[model samples]
Target: MKRLLAILFFLAGGLAAELAHPVQCTLITASGPQQKRRKAQ
Candidate 1:
């Protein structure tokens, strides 16, 4: 039971990291379009 709990904890941590990475990348991508719009003005 201890081993199973440890594995689950490890998986949860990795999944959290993976999810955060994509969200950060998407925010940067979304902001880039606005920067271009501002520069045009």
Candidate 2:
């Protein structure tokens, strides 16, 4: 169906964007753990 294709396309675009800026993704992921550690402290 057209809607399914559109949803798949949207997901693919998001993945491509994430891959295009791996450093940003890494920074985001890295910050999450630090925030959790801060909360624990």
Tell me the TM-score of model 1: 0.51
List residue ranges in candidate 2 displaced over 4 A: 23-41
**Segments in model 1 whose C-alpha atoms lie over 4 Å from true places:** 23-41
Error of 1 at 32 (Å): 24
**What does candidate 1's lDDT look like per residue over 1-41, in tens digits?**
99999999999998898887754554444434343345565
lDDT, model 2, position 29: 45
Candidate topping TM-score: 2
lDDT minimum window of 10 residues, candidate 1: 28-37
lDDT accuracy of residue 32 in candidate 2: 41
Give the whole-model CA lDDT for all candidates, comma-separated.
0.75, 0.76
lDDT leader: 2
Please, what are the lDDT tens digits per residue for candidate 2 over residues 1-41? 99999999999998898898764744444434343345555
